[model samples]
Structure formats: structure tokens, C-alpha cells
Target: MDDTPVRVLIVDDQTLMRQGLRKLLEIEPGVTVSGAAASGQEALALLATTTVDVALVDAKMPGMDGVALIRRLAAEHPSVACVILTTFDDDEYIFGGLAAGARGFLLKDTPPDELVTTLRRAAAGETVLGSPAAERVVARLRTDPHGTGLEALSAREREVGDLIAQGAHNREIARRLFITEGTVKNHVTALLRKLGMRDRTQLALFLAKHRDQR
Candidate 1:
């Protein structure tokens, strides 16, 4: 808690799942699994008492599923970055998870090394969400006939979308906006979730079609 490694909380319905996460994350340097919980209620109780940098929350659990868990976490523990680990990749879950303010959405079969890396990114407060299933969702959004979801973007998000349309990378957008790259990255994530697009590519393309209106 004092000048120590990054503290993490693991939340999953299965005891074996928590144990596996503990063992895997223990190997990462400067990262500690501070606590493990069996349900969203337990996770909320633990968060109220302890400090954690990132939380690996299972997407499905009894009583409170991952979506609601993320919503409550965002409302109660706004600083905690949630990385949803789930077995399913349904678009409904992806959109629902991001809407709940999860920083990253990962699958259970993700490699141990990638899992650690994703956790590090989350601890640093960046947004990252993508999976093979999300690719189709992205494409559908890009090709949707009315594009109503993306039309609701805020002014700043619209500007970012314009630049993304012009093929600017995150660093370039940061430079242009005079903001830190981290902020730009966060904006990109927010835009994706708000617009229901899958990634930057889809976002860029969305702007390509809607620039005249902007």
C-alpha cells in the first residue's frame, strides 16, 4: 500500500479461476494480486476497504453479472480500471461491458503473457477492447444504413474522428490537440464505445462518410 508494487483485485465466481489468476499474475514484476473475490458483492466490499489499481472481473457471475459489476465499480470505485475476462465474445456483451466503463475486455483463453500486459495497460489507465468477434461488430457498424449511433458523438469526439478519418495515429492526434498521448488514447476508447464502432479503423471510416455533416 506504501511505495509498493501495483495492487490488483481479482473477481470471478469460480474459486479455481481466482487461484489461477493469482498464480499467473504473481510472476509479473512490480504487480501484486492484493485480493481475490468470488462475486461482485464481495468485490465491492473488498474495494471499500482496500486500494487496488486494476481489477480482473469475470464477465459472468451469479446475482451480479460483469456488466452490472462494472457499472457499480465505475460509480463507486471510479479509479479502478476493470479488465473483463469472459468466455463469450457476443457483441451485446462487448457494447454492454464498455458502456459499464470497463477499460479492457479480454477473453479467458488469452495467453498469460498477454494478460499481464493488458493488466499493465489498464493500470496505466488506457482503454483497450477488441476480439475476433468484435471485428464483425465493427464491420457492421461501418456498413450500417443510417449510422445513427455515430451521429451522436460529442464535438471533441467528432474532431478526433475527423483526424482518425485522415489517418492520423494516436500520437499525431495528441500532438495536434496538445494533450498527452494517454489522453488521446482514452478519448479514442470513449469514442469507440459511444459510437458502437469496434476500433480506430471503423471510427476513421465513420468520419469519412460523415465529414460533411460535421
Candidate 2:
């Protein structure tokens, strides 16, 4: 596990939610709330000044939604992980956030401990998702399994892909596979390119549909 405390930035339109999340995170041992933002723009502004390991973003916001902010973060601050924390569990918002490079998808009503754990996992480079969000992704995969081209991936890529589908981060995957994290990252990059997937979320969804076969 990472020894450094995970720095988090809360982004939500509601002041109460932000305050609650901050308070909750501040109490956790290996986590800290670096800052809070009322909107995606404000979140971006904060990112410009403060460096955070993870950003807990709301799905719906007045100006730039979580999906857009996630996309921008992916482009501008690739190191920072984004996690969705919202009340809505709609398929569109969940998948949109994932496609935009969000490492996690969690509901607003999640238990405090689980939220902290998810943030820590995200900070550790894992693709964490709430149970409902995971279920939604699995359902989507069941509906559209044929178009993903999972067969194109090599055997090693398949191994990496399966671990990714299981929500294993690069470090964990590396440890499990007896390979270096850099090698795992290479496999991830190659597999993603081979599958023509946008990110690990899509890769996981594709694998979830075919998990029975594997």
C-alpha cells in the first residue's frame, strides 16, 4: 500500500455534501481532503493550484458536468484520478463518467467507510465502482457483447484485461502476475489499443460480458 496519505478534492454543487465528505475523509487515517469545489470550473481552478490524488466529483453540476471535468482532467492532469459521487445511478451518467477517464463511480449515499476506501483505491490507481454502478456496467455489457472485439487481444493482453475487469490496479496486477508495474502498464496500453477501447472502464465492461467464457 502507498505510505503517503491520499489527497482528495471534493467537487459537488451542494455545500452540505462537500462539507460532509470533507469531514468524513479528514477523519480517515490514510486520506485527507485537500479542497472542495462547488462546480466543475471551480474544481478545475483548484486543480490548477493544488495537486490532489483523487477528485470526488458529482455527476450533475450547473456548468461543466462531472463527465466533462473528468475528460478535461484526463487530458490536462493525467495523474489525478477522478471518481464520480452522485445521487443518480443512470446508465448514461455512469458510462459517460467512465468513458471520460473516471477511475471510480460511487453514489452520494455510500457509507462513509466505503467512500473513504473507494477514494483510497482510486488514489492507488484502481478502477473502483459502487455496487449499483458495477451492476449497471455488467448489464450494459450483457446487452452489447458482440461489438467489443475481445478476440483481438493477445493471450498476455487477455490476462491483463481480466485483472483490469476485476478492478485490479497496475501495482496489484503486477504483483499478482509477477511482473513490473511498467510492464503491466505496457500491456494495458497495448490491449486498450488492440481493443480500441477508450479506457479501463470500457475494457472491464467488455470483459464482464464475456467473463463466463473466460
Clashing pairs in 2: none
Candidate 1 TM-score, true structure as reference: 0.65
Tens digit of per-residue lDDT, candidate 2, span 56-131: 9998898787787888899899999999999998765677678678999998889988988898889889999999
Q: What is the lDDT of residue 2 in candidate 2?
A: 55
Residue-pair clash count for candidate 1? 0
lDDT of 1 by residue, 1-214 (tens): 4445778999999989999899988988878998999999999999988999998999889988777788788888899999889998865456667766888888899888778878878888887765654574576477654544554456787777788889999899989988888988878876765555655786788778877766
Clashing pairs in 1: none
Point out where model 1 deviates above 4 Å. 1-4, 133-137, 144-214
The alpha-carbon root-mean-square deviation between model 2 and the true structure, to one decimal in Å, is: 13.8
Candidate 1 lDDT at 39 equals: 95
Task: Report the lDDT of model 2 for residue 136.
Answer: 73
What lDDT does each candidate get?
0.80, 0.83
Per-candidate clash tally: 0, 0
Give the least accurate 10-residue stretch of model 1, judged by summed lDDT: 144-153
